[model samples]
Target: MYHTWMRFFTPGPAHHRLGLVCLGVGLQHGTLPTVGPRTLDHHVAVVVSTGRGWFRTPDGRRTAVTAPALLWLTPGVPHHYGPDPDTGWDEAFVDFTGPTADTYTELGYIEPHRPVVALSDAGAARATVGRIVRAARRGNPLLEVETSAAVHELLVTLRRARADTAPDGEQVLQALARDACKPLTVADHATRHGMTPAELRTAVRRGAGCSPKDYLLGIRLGHAKELLAATELPVAAVARRVGYDDPAYFSRLFTRRVGMAPVRFREQQAHTVPGGWSDQVPDPDDPPIIGRTPTG
Candidate 1:
């Protein structure tokens, strides 16, 4: 959601040789209204705080930005983007331009071709946007110098995101497929193209060093382990949570993958507690029924 009011500069008496303009725009939780496309001579950067959306340039390249992506727009580039209908978007944006405006361009930093750059540190990017917006609104004497400095940091972050994409590409895909479902099979993945299951298995192994089934199993077991470590549920409950209904089968698979049975793993961890352990207390914080006492 873009802010409803757009600030503009006055032409006459307001005109000055050294002008520093800053505006802060924020949208709450609602669908973005239709906006007419336009171009500007100022630098524009949008930091999406929540939800998902697509940034489409006039040339038809569309980049998707969700919770982790920052959008960069340069002067004189025609652009249009808004929130997805299902989930409304939240974003902070700032546009500033002056004599030192070429600093961003000189670095070849603005890549509107890749309109949305996913932020490695989303929190840091959000904080930076807040600072940029405040600096612009301050109308300080050194606005150009301060704003340019902030822009420099933003450019470096953008470059780092570009470099990080390649290494994480396959991992991201595997994670996506695994999350799509526990029953996600190699045949289903292979059908992503016209390829067969063997081809998909070969490709996944070549790129990820593991078969598709093994990769999916790793995801499932990783999820099961987290449940075991974080919750007090029984082995059956943990197995069900990770998509297995039969505790025995889940235990067999877990032992095969983890080199230990689930109960053994839990017992090993319990023995590591300081004063020994007891399951007599239904809740860890409450007092035990009879002979049980708190662990040291």
Candidate 2:
């Protein structure tokens, strides 16, 4: 409902020395609209506060740049974005660039691959942007420094919001459990899920109360026990089926971990009371979904 702005700031020498400055900012209501696709020399982030719109790249990729989130327009990236004429989005944006900005990108605070981060705490994000607008509009004496601080806060808000909306550490742990049969190292599994080895280790410990390696080992050992009890497969075949390449190596490791050799465990299980052994076996990673009801 307020007027949109596209005014440039007359930055001071100190702002230039700090290597960080807010070039421009605005609230894009119906008063201002994006005409077409074009690239720019600086970075801009636009938060869609209401309504709906679409963002497109030169590579023919398009995103539904909807409300409660923001989209990035990186420097020199051929991009186009606009609101629906009938349901134009209300947006607030800040155009920024400098060494500090580059440093944030280097530190993974600003990831182009994850251009649109959900404002899970929408009020906080709005409040941060409001500070930037206030600083700019008032032409405060320390406008650049104050606005820069607000921008940093905005970046942190983006990160916290995304984290708030992301799946829990336990979800990642359970996902890895589901694929326990895969011959993947803890580091490999962690990388696939966009986490470092250290991060994965900590997450596994926190979520599953064990190390990543140990969690997978528990799953593998559980499956091994099931196979040994229910099937007639040889030790070597069972080892290979459960992702162990070397039968002797598997036997040694299994013996060390399970407190008995694979063959001996099978023999001991065979004497167990009928029908009890099957129930004692834990289910596989992917269970049958034939009888499950779909949830919302």
Candidate 3:
């Protein structure tokens, strides 16, 4: 028998507001029943372990995800999923909370909730599934760190998968990330890409799901996170590094979308590292913003 497990959170104080949960799901050589399109008030995720399946989302989007692939479902959007008929499917899923939950949604990292994805080249998926399953088996503080590390790896995998699909998108994203610490405009980007401003805007939205300007801004914010977490730099320097000339404006934007100011988020992360902080960190980079918004 397949059992569904879930966890919910009741927000009270800032420190007590986050929630996390995971489930191991399976369906024998039979069709998995269709369920209502459910929306998460927080972040959610699904990883297929075996078999093949198709899922129809609330918006009528049909996704064909096979074993070893991942289905990232962010909060506030209607979602529905089930097994594909040619073969049955088994899956593992996890949901958690943090300041970046909304930011993930804004980037479309969790939208269209049920896209069938190829799980090829995802080193983190295997390790994460193992960690989550082990945690369910062991249930200890060690599990918490393992799960958190796995989640971070999964997020990075999703970002990479988005870029690997479109080299142009990847290039554009890198450019945006690298330039995030400076002032830029679509026209400037278009000129660099050898495209007209209008053409660039259309291309960006079509491929990345957001206008170039918004995507660039996201990159800047992502960089701001790096400076806050990995360095001792003040928010002002971080803002400038990510292309925001005005620190106050950057802080406001970060707080509004990311749910916390840069300083607060940094503090929160400082105390939450899975292990001791490492000096060897990536060069404060921003990932390409794919799925920046809903397609329909």
Candidate 4:
């Protein structure tokens, strides 16, 4: 016999614009019966946290499903799976779909190609599903939005937990981020990491879903944006700080990518302080003193 708890939702069309909406979530354990060899129109992420099972492909190949694994049931994909009759398995699943689901698939976060992915750990993903389970309470006003957001988090958590992701690729990504403002070419970065340019490209694409050049540019541009918004630094100085020595080229690139000239973006994003402007950033650990009278 199997134990199961599940909730399904039909969020309004407006909720679909949130980029990802949760259609359902479930938790189950014990000797669950077999599921269909039928096709689904949406995606479901079935996370098995314990025990073992087997999955049958449309081609009729049966693959073992071990604990701490993810089974991706994608649109139009036929799936058949069940826990072992003797041992059973513990499982949590989230069904989700939206335009962003396509984007995520392209980014390698949702792997339809590799349906049965072994996970290094399922704890974090299970915790995220637990949040969805709690939010599934009937009559909750924020149900749609809360569960939708949690679905996005669950995708990222699952991606990170995949046992196939190379630790070296993760290190390469971290190194690239650390030196994003170093004004180095992709080849130079590759050399620094003791990898050939092609190897670096492969690593970045696998780890970040982008080429090394694009990844570095994204980091540089992000830092430029923060500087533009938070500091009064001149455009040329900002350019130099983000690895572009030529302010004109920087302005053109920023305009093309951000849809605004740097000066215009700064003007639009300038922040005003409650009192006279101060450059000091507040410590996040300190609690805010709310409703306090202002001192002269």
C-alpha lDDT of candidate 1 relative to the true structure: 0.62
In angstroms, the error of model 1 at 216 is 44
Higher TM-score: candidate 2 or 3?
2
1 or 3, which is superior by TM-score?
3
Among the numbered candidates, top TM-score falls to 4
Superposed by TM-score, candidate 2 places the C-alpha of residue 254 at a distance from the truth, in angstroms, of: 40
lDDT tens per residue, model 2, 1-296: 33576656756777866776788777767624664577788777777777777777677787776677778778877777788777777788888777787877754567676666566545677788888887876646877888777778887776666543346785897789888878888888998889999998877764554678988999998888888887778999989888899999999999999999999999988544544443433356655468875231
Worst 10 residues of 3 by lDDT: 19-28
lDDT winner: 4
> Over the stretch 6-72, how does candidate 4's per-residue lDDT look in tens digits?
9999999899999899999999999998899779899999999999989998888999999999999
Better of 2 and 4 by TM-score: 4
TM-score of 1: 0.44
The runs of at least 3 residues in candidate 1 whose Cα sits more than 4 Å from the true structure, single-residue gaps closed, are 1-29, 99-103, 136-145, 161-296
lDDT of each: 0.62, 0.76, 0.63, 0.92
RMSD of each: 15.7, 15.5, 11.0, 3.8
Q: Write one digit per residue (lDDT tens) for candidate 1, span 1-296.
A: 34443333232223223443342333244577634377776667676768898878788777676866677777778888878888867666666555444544443455545667776656665566555556555346655555556655655555555434455446545554556334445676667656788876665654444667776777778767766765667999888877787899999999998999998877665333443334343665664557766453
lDDT of 4: 0.92
